[model samples]
Target: MGGRLPMSGMEGFLAGLAHPVIGPDHLLFVLAIGALASTQAGGVWLPVVFVLTGLGGTLLHLAEMNLPLLEIFVSVSLVLAGWLLARRQTPGLAVLLGLGAIAGIFHGYAYAESIIGAESSPLGGYLVGLATIQLGIAVAVCQWCQFLRLSKAGVTEANGSGRSVENLLRYAGFTFFGAGLAFLSGALPSL
Candidate 1:
């Protein structure tokens, strides 16, 4: 299980980044939330809180809590998040935390299921891979939010506005909703 890397360091790292489930849809959702949080609150803490709550939700799924209506919850989250962002409505802290936790359930379930299926390797190595993918998405989202902030503030030569941020958030919500539907349909594997 603790065997040496099968591929070169760079190759392994890139492969980790290329996780199918953690690809575009996941990335966009996280980034959209981050951008919305940054624009509304003018701080990163809220987004960080959101991410951590998501992690907690993932842990819950792994614990086998058997949350009912998981698909409905996820779909609602997407719609609500999109509607809020499009309307430029700043969500309260409680709402943010709740939404983050709910979103985490769906994301976490998928993640835990994937890990269990790929249990051929050392548990530690598998966990590290999971963490790496999650962290990579986080970093990408944060950077994107920062870029949006800079552009909106006119700190950068690039022209960006509130509308652009709103649109991104809306798209993210739609994508998340689609993913939730796919999950519900069993088109995607479940934990």
Candidate 2:
């Protein structure tokens, strides 16, 4: 009789870390965007939109919607997000929603592809886990932004009057761009 093999503790730990570490490019993308969003608006809704969009994107990917030029889209997101952050201009809710939705598609695709053949029930659980992690990261970033805003270190007056915030956003955008590039180059393995 054939027997099923169980995962050892270390193996399990590694398996768990795999998704966050290497399975999807979304982790980096999400974090980058979260940092940028925190700088723009210190609210939970922004990250919520990001999470929802990612889930929506996953659903679309499962439906076999081919997002042609996904790499380019991600790259653009990074660039635009960075620009928005660096500029310190207030982004309308509609714009945030649109960006989140578009970015989420790629994120979801990566997640879905990573867990193919896993139990359907687990998919929801996985998404919840993903959302929880993202929320934590977003909150942390928001707190950091608040600290920066309150601090007087290197604070500069810019055209938008939120030059510090803009710098944060620019950094976030560049990080996102770098992450996307790494993913595209296959330097980071996707599940």
TM-score top scorer:
2
TM of each candidate vs. truth: 0.60, 0.68
Tens digits of per-residue lDDT, candidate 2, 62-137, equal 6777876665565556555555665556487567767876777666566566544445555555666666666677
lDDT for model 1: 0.52
Tens digit of per-residue lDDT, candidate 1, span 14-133: 433444245444554555555555554444554555555655554565567676665455555555555565665657766765666567556555444433323224333544454466
Error (Å) of candidate 1 at residue 122 is 3.9
Per-candidate Cα RMSD to the true structure, in Å, reads 5.8, 6.4
Inter-residue clash pairs, candidate 2: 85-166, 85-169, 86-166, 86-170
lDDT of each: 0.52, 0.59
User: Total clashes, candidate 2?
Assistant: 4
For candidate 2, report its TM-score: 0.68
**What residue pairs are clashing in model 1?**
none
- Please list the residue runs of candidate 1 whose C-alpha ends up more than 4 Å from where it truly belongs after superposition: 1-25, 117-121, 152-191
